[model samples]
Target: MSRLNHQWISQLPIKKITNVKPVSGGDINEAYQITTPDKKYFMKVQPNKTAKYFGHEINGLKALGKAIRAPKPLYNGQINGDAYLVLNWIDAGYQGSQSELGQLVAKMHSQTNDKFGFVDNHETGALNKTNNWDDNWSRFYVEQRLEPEIEACEKLGRWNKWRQQHMDNMISAFRKYYQNHEVVPSLCHGDLWSGNYMFDTEGHPLLIDPDAVYGDREYDLAMTTIFGGFNDEFYQAYQQTFPFDDGLQDRLQWYRFFYLCLHLILFGETYGGSVDSILGGF
Candidate 1:
C-alpha cells in the first residue's frame, strides 16, 4: 500500500475497471479475475500473511506455458511489496458429464521435453528441477523425487518414519511391481487437480495455473486419478490413445506416496492416514 506503488498501479492502461472480485481457487493463495471494458486478465495475489511458495508456482506456469491449451502467462510482477501474476483469462466452463477427461489428458501427456528437467528461471524465483531425466523411472522416482520429500518429512518430525525407518520394504515393492521402462519425458503439469484444469466455452480443454515439470507421465495421471477428476470415459479415452500398464493396483501408491507426503507436509494429519495406508501396503 505504498504511495509510489499505488501511483504505478494507477498507470496501468485499463479501459474501464469493471470488477475485481475474490475468486476462490486454493487455500494457500488468492485468485481473482480483473475485468476491463475490452478484455479480462486473471490475477493471483499471494497471501502475504504466509511464506512465499508462489515463486515455485510462477516457475511451474512458465514451464507449462508452451502447452497447446493452457493459459498463457502474461506478466508477473510485484505490487505494494508482494507478488502477483497476471495471465490470459479464458471464458472457462465446466463439463461434469463429459467422460473425455482421460483422453484429453492423454493428449497433454503427448507433450514431451528435450531431455528431462528444464532450464531454470531466476526472475520467477523457481527452483531448479533437480532429477535424473534418464529413461529409468524408478531410480528417478526414488532418488531424485521421493527422497527429498522423505527427508523433509523427517526433518519436520512427520510420520514418514514408518517408511523411512524401513526403507527397504518400500523399495522392494517398487522394484517388484511396477515395470515401466525408460519413459520419455512428458512435460507434466506437476500438480494436476480438478482446480488446475478447465473447459472453455467450446468444450475444448484448457489447463491453467500449472505447477509444471518433466517426469514420468504416470505421476501426473496418478494424482488426477486419486483426487477424482475425470471419470471412466476420460480413462477410456486415454486408454485408447496410450494404454496404461497393468497392475496399477499394486503400484498406484508408488506414485501416490509422493503426493501424500506433500499433503502431509502442507496440510498435516488429515493426510496422515493416506500416508500410513500407502506405506502399510508395502
Candidate 2:
C-alpha cells in the first residue's frame, strides 16, 4: 500500500494522494483511483520500457477529443522516468446493449483522418502496423497491415503455417474486391472492442485506450464484430448515419481477417486453431 501510495501521490505532479485506490483494468499498465481536494482522477503508470505507445497515446487522446467522443487525456509525466497518464474519468457505466454500442462506435469512426495516417507509430499487439498510408485500402491492408503481422508470427513461431496459402489466396481475392471498393481514410479507434467501449450516464459511448490509426473505416467496424461485441442495431444506426456499400455484408470478412491474425499473434494457441480455420474458410 505504501509503495503504491507513494507511486501515485509522490510521483504525481500533485500532492496528497488521499483515498488512493486501485482501478480495475485489463491493461498491462497499472491504474488507480485517487481522491484529492479537487476531485477523483484516474492515473495509470505506463510501462515505459516496452511502451512506444505513450507518445501515440497522447495523440490518440487528442484525436478522440477532437472527435468529441471517448475519454480525454488529461496529464502525463514521468516518475523516475516511467511514464504516467491521467484521464478525466467518465463513469463508463453500461448504458445499453449491443445495438446501441454499434451506433455510437460508427459515429466515432465517422470522424475523418488527417490525409491518410498520422505521424505517430505504435504496435498493435505484437505486430507493428504502418503509420504510412496510401490511397489504396487493399494495397495498404495487405502490404502494410496483414503482411507485417504474418511475417512476425512466422518469426515468433506463433504463426499457423497452414494458413499461408489461404492468406495468399485471400490477398489475391481482396485485390480484386478492393478494385471495386471505394477507399476513404476514416479515424479509427485502431482497436475498438466491446471492452474498449463504455456507456456514460447519457448512454453515449466514451471510448478509451485507442490504438488510433487512419485506415479504412471498415477496419474499425469490422474489428467490433471480430470477437462479437456489437449487434445489428449498431450496424443499422451506423448505416443510417454513414451508410456503407450494398455489398458490405458479403464483404465483412475482408476487413476482419486482419485482427484474427492479430489475435493469433497476441494470445498464442487459443487463437491458433481459429486462425487456421478462418484461413481455411477463405
Candidate 3:
C-alpha cells in the first residue's frame, strides 16, 4: 500500500491516527480501514480524480439511507491529486436476513421522482453516463443509456453488423412495449450486484457503492437476477412488499442486456456472449 501523505492525513477531521490497513473496495478505488484510538472508518481513494468524483456517491448514500440501511458519509476531499471519501465503518458479519433485505430494497424503490435521471451524471470505469432528466422513460433509456454504451462498444472495435441488427431490433421492441406501459420513475441502485451489499456486525443488510438513478424499478430488479446472491426468500419478500406488474420477468431481460453490454465494454469479450444472449432474445 502506498503511504498516505502526512499533509493529507492532517487535513482529515480525525486525529491521532494509529493504523491504516488495506481492505477490499472493488476494482475502482483504493480502499483502507482507518484506525484511531477511539474509532474506525472506511475510506476510498481515487487517484488523480477531483473531490467531485465522490459527489454522486455521497448523494446516493444520503438517498438510500432514507429508506434502507446505508453507510453514513462523513467527509470527502482531494489531496495530492487523489480524491477520497470517508464513511462510517461497518463491521462485517455473517448471516443477514435475505427477506429483510428484500423488504428494505422494495421500500427504497417506492421513492419516486418526477422524471427519470439524477441530480448529476455518473461514470462507470472510464465511461460517462448522461443522466439528463426526461419525462418519457423509453426515450430516456434508449437515448441516454443504450445509445451511449453502443457508441462506446463501436469505438472499441467490439461492434459488428450482427450486433447492430439485433440492437436495432431490441431498441424497437423496448420502445414499442413501453409505449403502452406506464413506468414510474423510482429510485434505483444503478449497480446492485451482490458485492455491493454486505451484512453488518448486527446481521443487518447495508447497501454500499451505489450508482443511483431514478428510472424504472424493474431496471434495478434486473441487476438482482444477473447475479446469484439473492435467493427465493428475498424475491418472495420483495413481491409481498411491492408486487410487480405483469410481464416483469420478460422486461427484466432487456435491463439485463444493458448491464451485460456495459460489462462487455468494461471487461471485453468475456461478457460478449452474455450480452448477445439477451439481444438475441429480442
Candidate 4:
C-alpha cells in the first residue's frame, strides 16, 4: 500500500485497517479491499493532476440513493496529492433477475429534471462529459455528447472523407431523427453498460462507477445495447414502465453512434468501422 492510501484509511471515521489487499476489476482506477478486524471497505484511487472524479462520483451515487442498490459513499478526499474514494464493499451475489434490474432502472429514470445535464462535468474513462445545461435534448446530445468525440477523432486522424461526409450529414439530420419521438430530461446512468452494474449478495442490482446526468433516457438504454450482457427482459421491463414512443427503434442506432465515436477515440480503430457503419446509415 502507498502512503496516500494509508493516510486516507487512517483518517476514516472507522477502526484502523489491519490489512489491505489489491482488488482487480477496475478499468480506470486502482481498486482495493481494505479490512479491519470486523469490517471491509472498497477504495478506488486516481493519481492527482489526472482526473478528479471522486466528488462527482459521490454525488452521482447519492443521487441514485436507495432507489438503486449502489455502493454507499463513505470517505472521499485528496491525500498526499492522490485522489481517493471509499465506499462500503458489497459482496458478490448471483446474477440478479433481469426483470428486477429493469424495473429498478425504470423507476430511477422516472426522476426527471427541467434540463438535460448534470450539475458538474464528469469523466467517462478519461473523457470529460459536458454537462452544460440545455433545455433541448437533441441539441445537447449534438453539441455536448457527439461533437466533442467526433472532433477528437478527426483531430486524431481517425476521421476520413467518407466518414466525415456521413458524419456531417448525420449532424444535419440529427434533430430530425432525435425528435421523431417525445423525450424528457430523464435521469440516466450516463455510462450504463453491463460492466458498470452488478448483482449484490441479495440478488439485487447494484450500480457502480456512474457518470450520472439528466439526459434523454434513451441514451442510457442505448448504452446497455452497445455492449452485450443486458438481458432482453431488462429492456422489456423498462418499456413496460416508461415506454418509448414510435420510432425509438430507428433512433436507437443513432444514439449508439455517439458511444461508437467515443470508443473510437478512447480505445482505438477497432470501433472505427462500427462508427462508419452507423454514420453511413444516415
- Colliding residue pairs in candidate 1: 99-234, 102-234
Q: Please, what is the TM-score per model?
A: 0.81, 0.89, 0.97, 0.92
> Between which residue pairs do clashes occur in model 4?
none
Task: Give the Cα lDDT of each candidate.
Answer: 0.66, 0.73, 0.90, 0.81
lDDT of 1 by residue, 1-282 (tens): 232233645544444666666666645556777788888887776634222445556666665555556677666666555566677788866654345556666777788875665443212222223544455566666766677677666667785456665555887667655474456778777778777788887777767766666777888887886788667677778789878877655556677888887888767788888888777765
| Tens digits of per-residue lDDT for model 2, 1-282 | 344646536767666657778788737778877788877788777654432447788798788778656666777776655667777767656566555666666666788754567667775457776778567677777878888988988987875546788888878888998797677778888888878877777777667888887777877877877777777777888888788867776566867777777777777778777677667776
TM-score, cand. 3: 0.97
lDDT score of residue 117 within candidate 3 = 94
- Write model 3 residue lDDT over 31-91, tens digit each, in one string: 9899999999999998899999999999989999988889999989888888989999999
Q: Per-residue lDDT for 130 in model 3?
A: 85
Ranking by lDDT: 3, 4, 2, 1
What value of lDDT does candidate 2 attain over all alpha carbons?
0.73
Of candidates 4 and 1, the better by lDDT: 4
After TM-score superposition, what is the CA distance of residue 218 in candidate 2 from its true location, in Å? Answer: 1.1
- For candidate 4, the lDDT comes to 0.81
**How close to the true structure is residue 263 of candidate 2, measured as C-alpha lDDT?**
77
Poorest 10 consecutive residues by lDDT, candidate 2: 46-55
3 or 4: which has the higher lDDT? 3
lDDT of 4 by residue, 153-202 (tens): 77788888898788778887878865665568987887888888889878
Clashing pairs for model 3 are: none
Ranking by TM-score: 3, 4, 2, 1
- Model 2 bad stretches (over 4 Å): 1-8, 48-52, 97-100
